[model samples]
Target: MSEVAFRLFAERGFDNTTVEQIAAAAGLSRTTFFRYFGTKEELVLGRVGEFGREIADALAARPAGERPWEALRRAFDVIAEPRPGETGAPMDIIRLLSDACALMTRQWEKTQGWQSMLVPEISRRLGGPGPATDMRAGALVAAAISCLDAATDAWTAGGGVVSLADLTDQAMGVLREPGDVPG
Candidate 1:
């Protein structure tokens, strides 16, 4: 199903690919497709809720002494790493997202959701939520997501010459630097 979705997304663009088309391409009924994915965006994003949960779990598992931001940074590094059997080229996916406002909005919402889920875990790790802990968690998660987005955009614009890790590091550097403007 994902393979079909990826090919259709690649060929026709994400916004142009209908759920019915994806379903037909996959030799499944529309009902079956809906059963598998709640929406066309889900077909493209593909189990992102699961990935977010995994990220949260990873953040929760970090060493007790590590700062919440550090734990999240480490967790993000691991999440951003390419794994076996992932569908669609990262650059292509990034480009598709950049070109689609709806996808970009969805991506932003997903990032926010991930961050929200991470906050309690981070607060727990910090032994409780205070103004400082809350602020740090929000800032760290926001910075990480911003960096990931910028890195993806840079990688796409560079014709995929730069690895996602490199882009991520660049994003992290921008975040760490004092007085850097938000992109």
Candidate 2:
């Protein structure tokens, strides 16, 4: 279903494509399409929300004693790796989302949603719950997401010539610097 939708989105352009078109292309009924996806946006960006859970789960799978920031970075390695049956490259999906104004806004919302899924584990790594730990966890999650956005923006601007995982690590690494941000 997604492969069909993605190909259509890629070929026809996301804004130009319609749910009915996607359904017909995939040989599914409109009702069946609605059963599977609520909207055209869902067909494209649905996996995004799921990636939050995957990242959180990845964080959980890291060594118990790993540093919080390091664990988070390792967790994101799962994201840089292509999905089992993804129809587009990570760069292609980034381009797709950037092409549509509404999806870009929704992507921001969905990415922000990752914080809630991540805070508990981060807090645990910060030595369990408390005002300081919770606050720190929230900040760390925000910082991590910011690093991802920075990496993504860089990737888009640089023609995706660099591996996104490497760019992400570079963004995260910049934060670990003891000196001011490089100009």
Candidate 3:
């Protein structure tokens, strides 16, 4: 259903596309579509929620002794390293989201949601929360997400001329800077 929505969103502008159209294209009833996705925005950005969980789970699964920054880098690496035949979803979604003001706003909201979910888990992994621990967790998560954002932005701007995984690795490498030491 999402892939169908993605293709429709790409072929027809996001604003021009409708739930009814997406439902029809996917051969699902509008009722079924509603059962799956509450809003068109949710349908479009659904993978983001899954990615958020993936990052959190990846972080949680890392060696307990790993530094917070290093764990985050590894967590992000999970998503940054694409599987086979997975080249186009992000580019298409980025293009679609870039053009739509609503989705862009929702994107920001979604990111904050992801960050909120990460903070406590990060704090836990760093030996539980204090003001300092919470602050570090928040900052690290923000920086990691920013690295991904910058990499994706660059990828989109360059028409995907460079590998996104490499870009992500480069961007994320900044976290290793000595100045990025967490509390």
Residue-level lDDT of model 1, residues 1-183, one tens digit each, is 888988888899888989999999999999999898899887656545556777788887888787665677667755466666666644455667777777778876776778777777766665556534576556667777777777777877787687777778777776565434221
Model 2 pairs in collision:
none
| TM-score (all chains, Cα) for each model | 0.77, 0.88, 0.82
C-alpha RMSD in Å of predicted model 2 compared with the true structure = 3.6
Candidate 2 lDDT tens digits, 33-140 = 999889989876777887789899999999988788889889987766555555755556787887888799899999999999998888887775653457878888
Q: What global local distance difference test value does model 1 have?
A: 0.71
Give the winner by TM-score.
2
lDDT of 3 by residue, 1-183 (tens): 887888887788889999999999999899999998899998778876777888888888989888887787788765566566553355566777777888887887776778876787778766656524577778878887898888877877787778777888788886677756663
Q: Is candidate 1 or candidate 3 better by lDDT?
A: 3
Clash pairs (backbone) in predicted model 1: none
The lDDT ranking, best first, is: 2, 3, 1
In angstroms, how far off is 98's CA in candidate 3?
A: 2.9
Question: Of the candidates numbered 1 and 2, which has the greater lDDT value?
Answer: 2
RMSD per candidate (Å) reads 4.3, 3.6, 2.8
Q: What local lDDT does model 1 show for residue 102?
A: 79
RMSD, candidate 1, Å: 4.3
Error of 2 at 1 (Å): 1.6
